[model samples]
Target: MSFLHLLAKKSKRRNVKLLRHLQDVASIAMKIARNGGLDERIAYIGAILHDIGKASTQFQKTLDVNFRRPPGMVFRHEIASLFFLSLVDEQDRPAVIEMVVAHHKSIFKDIGEMGLLDLNDRLRDCFEVHAVGFDIWMPNALEILHHLGLKVNPITKEVARKSFEAAVSYCEVKRIGYSKWKGLLMAADHLASDMESEVGDILPKLFITPDLNFYNQQSIWYPLSFIPGNDPRKHTLLKAGTGTGKTYFLLKRCTGRIFYILPFQASINAMYERIKKDLMDTDAEIHLLHAASLLQGNGESLKEKVLQRHIGASIKILTPYQLASLVYATKGYEALITDLAGCDVILDEIHTYSEDAQALVLKIVEILYSLNCRIHIGTATMPTALYNHLLQIMGGKEQVYDVSLPDNVLDTFDRHIIHKAEKIEDLGPTIRDAIKDGLKILIVVNTVERAQKLYRWLNKENLNVDKMLIHSRFKRSSRRALERLLQNDFNRKEKPCWVVATQVVEVSLDISFDLMITDVAPIDALIQRFGRINRIRNAHTIGKYKDIYVLPPPKNNRDARPYKLEVLRRTYDLLPEGELLQERKLQELIDKVYPEIEAPNIDLNAAFVAGKWRIRELYHAPKSALLDKLDIDTVPCIIESDVKLYELADNAIRLDMEIPVSYKILSFKNFPQLKIGNHPFVIPDGAYDVDEGLIAASLKLESVQ
Candidate 1:
């Protein structure tokens, strides 16, 4: 007798047999469940049966390269997979349903409205449509299940119909939050499909504790390194200046996998590279996570790219936005929670967040604490009230290892002399003198448009200096290349060059310059910007003050965006002119500028709250309004010419051809968009350049061909 063949995934380059895919998913799911303290058997079963619906002839036909899905034909494999729920025990049916019913979509209020519940409410023959030719496929699915060590009996159409009804009933009842079962299966399925034949070899590498002995090296210059990291406290709050080995101390505090959270992409990228280099000798897995992580890769295999986005890295450096999904209970949040549970999370530069972001970070801390994650926070400047709040959130002083430098050590970190300028143009002669002296100068603007304008003005001057401009608007590939040059070439002590950037360079860039000219920002932000200049402090560089000029705050509200005018004026007034910027006085100045930190008004949208979960169980938030409220850029766009290339290229290449833009700005412009997977809006080719980034304001829609 001949048996029918099935496929879980359609790949012309390799064998994607259904049974092998099921086994691969089951193996990964079992590992994840074990690490997250969930029931391994349930996870294994859910993973195995998640894709059994692919056994249908309809789905198999669609897998063919020449196949074209008929118009109005909606076939959900996940919904079809629900027909096999009876194969599991009655007690396990609920979890199995949760894993199967909505693994690919939301049960209710899905963005596309294609959720299981949506289809059930709209179509009277939803089950009947999925049940087409069920008799022919049922035997093959059972045989495959039996071959995978699962005991199976003949499942008739009546039995499958009842399973479908049960799954629909399970999804009908309103619940208070989301389920982890779906996330567990989704994560496993994604990993198995991505890793393919290499799943077994990669499984053992995940969730392993990294060897942190590399950070154990102590030196008198770095005081934090000498302090004992293994304390009785469950959390740590370390306050130290830049170049004081705070990162090393934080690493030394971790006893498990580490999630290093920074504020900006540039900083996260810099930290990712730094950590990978630091742990290069060990067999540690260091991954970078963000919107453009794939672009940051240096010839990493496809498997490595997948692993970078997935959980279980020894050390994963990412921005706080990646973790915000958990706070809002967005899709795949349960998987994130599962991965982050009982891990060491280091929140570096906690003071760098906006008012809304501050509230989000506080909530993130509460969630991490509930998950029993070892939280470590490090900051160069933190307001007194904010410091107290974080201490309270971390269970007060008893549970936290609070570390701060003494006045003497802080005095050694005094590295900049403040100079007030009326405007950037006012310091033209000073900038020229610095350039003539062969000094590296860093100019930081408040906005991308202003940064671009400055780069143009500098170019017009015809200055004989190596100049480069960097902001958050460039394409991923270009941005990655620029960052590499910023770190490798311009950062050299012997190289004297000029770099014009925005707030992206304000935190943790690891670049030092001889001079800095910046637009006035809030006191805390200005302090962070100051860290980028004269950053390398040592016995010879101690107490050596570099000149830093600050331009007056913008006159208009639109120009002074992203920062409150009152705070900017206060910061300017408090800045000492023609004198050393005292390291100890920074907190006092920050407190003066922001006397009291107001709690962000995001409680209404937040899923997790004051020691309780506000959202329903087994259901996720439809969308994250909090991200919009916080003013984060969540949209991607590409040049018009790249549309064809984007459609043909794989994920990594498509990401390279795309540019990240603010949704608020893009929507306001109302540019024509293309719904090709990533939903990138197509802009005129003249609007973008390889050297310059998105020129949205100068875009002429009619120029598009």
Candidate 2:
């Protein structure tokens, strides 16, 4: 048989044998490295030598179906790849070896297991066939090297041998910056291995900016009246009221690939669809990325989804958690960081995140700044302190284009009349009256328990109106369905319904209502909830149905965990009563509610420093098979009560039904009950409601301990 043909990789799943998957990886790695402006030759060499150990007969036998594999025999192909490093020059061997070993796992972690501590026995164990003393794989390795146009240099052979022998005691590999060089090789390997089927590039080719001329010329609904008019290539800080075309403004200002980040999946999904529809030009691909991104019927094949990770589309509408991969150093985060460098990012609705998330968001800003990303922050409720901090990071006000609506323009956009009450229970009669009056109502609570309770109470009252309840805990499929229904139902001109929800409805969802009643939350969150009411206004309905009812913080301190009680109290005290909610006062109110720039109990600088250190520390560590552990915060789990229901889940479609069980929930001992096979189920029967979603109390299951 020919040497090149003998070096082929046989895939049991696929019906084709490649000359070698390593060659394909090398080809792809070279392309990626050149595109990233790194040395393509080094990348190709690293890719070619990465899996040279698989050429061994013992490894080949392990691939045979009928072969009896030994129990304790572990074939570390990566370690074997280093044996042929002598084929390369002495100057390039260390970097090439780092790429080979660090591709699958970190070199720092697997050094002992890889046998750098005992070179001769390790070489014998890896290369010598069972019961055979001589290395038989060397001839095939030489054949493969000859076929790849690489000649073994006699001078470097002795040098490589000395280097390898010296490494038996201690191996010191040179530091290749984590985000670029090594990351590029890993990304190329992943992209090549996963690109099983043929697919076209779906990346966006959009460069046309959405200036005032485009908005005025394209449609009458979105007139260019109250948004920042700046060049798409500059850094921008935009402040505009709700319903003022902030999304349009952000999109219009992006000159390259865009990462439109929002706080909620509901919001991100909404933005994804909105951008996809508005652009409807086949020039660019707009992808929605979140936990349940695949489940959203985009008709993306498994191969396409995997490809998109390495070669991102023109625009990605995702939550900030997706960017958290960089901080966590998740596998393939290198690809994400590469995609994000020098890209235009829009951090929309920046005021709606939690304390921890808010801290992470700031840290992300720091990282993106260092990566030279053009960040445009848009928020209606941004505090002066936070804006100033971001401005300083972006090279101060001179570098950032500050965009805000004029006082008269802001007044014209004023559409909300704010009012406060001690409790929502007292507003039951008023809510019933509004339903009779045919006003669409939005009620937002701090917790799912509170939302479900409010939903049931209204149901028991026999309020004759259509009701839809939404929260975070619903099955992935159910939440998606409800979100679509809510969007469609609310858009209908004559629909007068009640949507009982938690903070899920705060940002990104395009639905607007005539009235909103929400529990006491942080001032910024309250403002975000208020944005949902009187959100879509016109000349005829400028100030009509602009009423919003806010319940004051509870007298008891127990309910304050979801939000700071002091902040809520201060926000409630400062809100205008029976008067137009001025947009100018938003920053002042936010500053007052959050006296310190950082949220209480969150040290932003400390978390950022720790994250920076961890990224550096993990650069040489072995790759973890469990990527979920590297995820920033949440843990996704399959939740189902019935064994039959869980059994019905086919492997292909099961991910659509999975839900993220927060880390806080999993920390409790025996907290979740019922397991379908090996996967943890968050609740048993009666916990997940078709309408209200997975009840918060049901997550605390305790039994069969």
CA RMSD per model (angstroms): 2.3, 4.8
Per-model TM-score versus the true fold:
0.94, 0.84
For candidate 1, write residues 512-580 as lDDT tens digits. 899999999988888889989988867778778899999988877877888888878999999999999
lDDT of 2 by residue, 383-491 (tens): 7788887788777777788888777666666678888777788998888888788889999999877888988988888877788888877767778788888888764
Each model's C-alpha lDDT?
A: 0.85, 0.66
- Please give the lDDT score for candidate 2: 0.66
Off by over 4 Å in 2: 1-20, 61-74, 89-95, 110-134, 138-173, 176-179, 199-233, 328-330, 600-633, 639-652, 666-682, 699-705
List ranges where model 1 is wrong by over 4 Å. 1-4, 11-15, 64-74, 171-178, 624-630, 668-672
Candidate number with greatest TM-score: 1
